[model samples]
Target: MEPLNYLASFIQSAETGSFSAAARRLGLTPAAVSKNVARLEASLGLRLFQRSTRSLTLTSGGERFLHQVGGAFSTVQEAIAGVAKDDGQPAGVLKVGMALAFGREHLLPLLDDFLLRYPGVLPDWHFDNHPVDLVGGGFDAAIGGGIVLSPGVIARELLRTDLLVVASPEYMKGRAMPDHPTELARFDGIVRRSASTGRAKVWTLRHDDGDEGQALLRPRVIFDDPEAMAYAAMRGIGVALLPMPHAARWLKSGALLRLLPRWRGEAGTVSIYYPSKKMLPAKTRAFVDHVVEHFRRPEVAAVFDSGRYR
Candidate 1:
């Protein structure tokens, strides 16, 4: 292998902290990766790692070397990718992270057309309701709301993810519809507990006139998933706070009814997150453009908009 290959092995092993894991990323055997690092050390006459039976830790020299060269190495890789992608064909595995329900209901429908357009690209998607480390986890892209923005990552907005309070017609059959956010206190509540914080979410509803009120929902049922909350609301469990994307379908089909149509909660947004635009891989670029274009359509945009639900 070339010296660059040895350096790449060292960097991957250092970042992941295990040769086996680095091997998976590099498409090499663990033994081969370890050997490449060893060769690189011999050539430089530097002990780069403190090796033991179960762990590998970088030495002072290794830390300094990595700090000096890591960014340049990444740039070199990106340049190579750019050159390959310049042919205007998007190919290879496109790894992405997304919430389960949103991926299935909204984005999955677009996959057939995307694949038909770019047959060379294969998608490897991970569905989780929580935020993921896009660069650290090696995801080409991720889709969701409230994903924290970090250096070297960018997002393209897809929809306004406004939170809506909704309940089934059956649940509200005998009860008078709430004319104000305060009246929501009278109904049962299907609340969402934050998975990361383990506390029930407190919703604050806002109106266009700059008035805001705390939605005082009595917690009769609780879930960690927004989709589950929507389903519970449809089954007459209780009035639930849900992001417009999750509740849109039900609201349109009359499975759920919106309450206090003038009020809504600001749930940041739903965006497609990806790496910096500079030298972006063809597949990643294509996928991002495709999704953004799809959402820009008037019919699709109206469906996910909170104002349309009113």
Candidate 2:
């Protein structure tokens, strides 16, 4: 037997999270699945799984190895199929994960152009406020901000913005504007609840002059979605801590007013994320390139410009 084939078994088990599940998927017994993974680990001189009686989890080296090679084999298959057909046209179900607000306001609008360019590809998009597991969930790509990069991924920044205070003109009509984050507690605050923790987030702010402050807010409205909180601010519910992508149009339209403009919460980068780039399938490659190039154009790029408040 080519011990090399066990590498595929290793990757499949990593994706499924258990030897039993991988065995069911691969039409093998759980014992065979475990043995193959153990052989692959032995061949590599590494411990791949931290095995327990009821579970299997990747070790640190296993995580890094997966990051480097997870989708490579399937991509090689796609490449071979392309060569056989004498074409490199992207054709596959391109699964994408995106944050709800940014996807709707930015990515969704530009997708028609991408589809036109890659007609062979089918887009499968999942938009939400929760975190995404790219490897386990089998997404081809994901787009959004504030994501902590997981074990097997890389992020290429498309845009960055500052989180600032925003409120509808109506909400601020008779109220004094906050000069610092310290004064934010006196006003009605609209804030976010952490999807992972279910607790309201604390605001740590920075001043242009380099002063800093933190606020533990008792929010009048707590939202799990960024766009919803921005909308709530626009409805005069309360002042919101919002990233510029969510606050930009309202600021330009005068529906919302920015307070303490010199002060901002942590700066953020919006990025397109994927697993290793070594041998990406044409569909994944095309969508990634298309989105990057789309944002590089002047008119489209201006909307995501950090200079707006700088």
Candidate 3:
């Protein structure tokens, strides 16, 4: 096999953490996969992986090689697709990283539609609340909210999400609703630990009267998961600050009610981020355009109407 093929086999083995799995994926035998990796490691004069009877793990050198070589592989794939007459059809594995809550509520439902439109494409999605290193993890793209800090990554804004102060009607049945940000301190706040920042999200409210205040809420119950936080808020546990869409269904059902509506904070933009390369694969570009166009629909925008609060 060629050097590039050996490198590709090595990457596949590292990603799947098993020679057998890589072999199945690449249509090679387990022995062939092991031999290719071993030869590649010898050519580079380094141990790329630490293997045992039960598992395999990448060495530091292996990790670095995967990151650098993955980009090179992506470039080669793009070049081949560009020159090929069948460039109109995108076919390849496209890995994506995104927030768990957002992906579940938004992206998951649209996945079937995407696959139907691009039947030749295969998608591998990794959903987590924490920030992901796309290039290191070999992700083709990531959907994220808030500020993106990675260098050499390009970001395109998709939509804006507004923060809402909401509580279950049962929680507010006897207690008075907070009319301003200052009053929020008296309420039992349900806080969600942010996966990206690794801290509890601080609630910031700006009133229509030109008054702005921020509060570092200590939750009566702290949930690392957004879905759990939404559930707790629905059960009348306490006031929760969340994106509008997460609380929308409950709000419409009268299970949760918005508080201090005029004091809601500024909108945060959701965006798709990827490597800042001159040429992106047609599959990735198509996915980005699909997501952007979906969000631009009037019905979708109404679900998380950032302008409603402002």
Candidate 4:
């Protein structure tokens, strides 16, 4: 039996936490994956996994071995792929995770272009509002904001926009325009809450003179989605401090008015994140390059600039 086959099976099973899942990922039967792992254990004279009917756990020895070589085979596969691709094109599944709104609003439209460019590669994407564990979830890359950087993860900033206070003309009607951030209390405030944490967010405004201020008003309406908050602001619900990307069209079309424009709210970034693999797979590498290039394009670059909000 080929040792590499068992090694691949072992790594896949360990990653998925189930032999059946590993089998699905590797295109083998569950029995075959179990048999391969058993053969590996016998060859190494060490039990790697603590298996049970309900769950699977890695023994201490298994953990140590995974730490050493969990990524090694992927690197080897990349080298072989590189050699093969010298005469052909890279082709495979590229799994990605992205935020729900941003993915639908910004990324989905660009898929046709990407597929046209890399016909051999397949795009498999998961869209969600919460952060995803890239490696543990078996994703090749993810695009989202406010993701906590994990050990094997790396992030490249795609765009960062300044947050601004905005409201519809109707919402601002008959309300006095406040000169300072403190005077914002005279109007109704619509604030956004974190979807993951369920905690309401407060705006920290920065002045040009190097002083900062936090919004003192309590939110009359709370939203977990940015689009909803933006729409509410457009419908004269209240003032919202939102990223410029969400309000760009409204602000540009005079649908929304930028209030206290000089006092910008908090800045946030959207980033592309991937595992810090020694030899990134061709599919992963291609998607990352394409996305980075996509953001770097002249048309896309201008809208994401924080300066536009001011």
Poorly placed runs, candidate 3 (over 4 Å): 1-77, 84-87, 146-149, 194-199, 216-218, 306-310
Candidate 2 structure quality by residue, lDDT tens digits, 1-310: 3554587678778877878766754567878988998888888999988999888899999999988876677776556657854256778688899988788888898888888987888899999766576665667888976666765577888977778888888989888877778888888889888766898888798887899998545589888877888889888998888887888888888888888878887646888988766546678888888899888899877875534753
Order candidates by lDDT, high to low: 1, 4, 2, 3
* Full-model lDDT for every candidate: 0.88, 0.79, 0.79, 0.82
Residues 1-310 of candidate 1 have per-residue lDDT tens digits of: 2888998899888877889867766778889999999999999999999999999999999999989988888888777776776366899999999999999999999999999999889999999999887765778899997787876679998887889999999999989998778788899999999877899989899987889999999889889999999988998989999988889999999999999998999877889999777537889999999999999999998887788778
lDDT of 3: 0.79
TM-score of each: 0.84, 0.79, 0.72, 0.84
CA lDDT of 233 in candidate 3? 89
State the local distance difference test value for candidate 4.
0.82
lDDT string for model 3 (45-97, tens) is: 98999999998999999999988887788687567678772547876788899
Considering TM-score, where higher is better, how would the candidates rank from best to worst? 4, 1, 2, 3
RMSD of 2: 4.8
* Model with the higher lDDT, candidate 1 or 3: 1
Q: What local lDDT does model 4 show for residue 81?
A: 76
The best candidate in terms of lDDT: 1
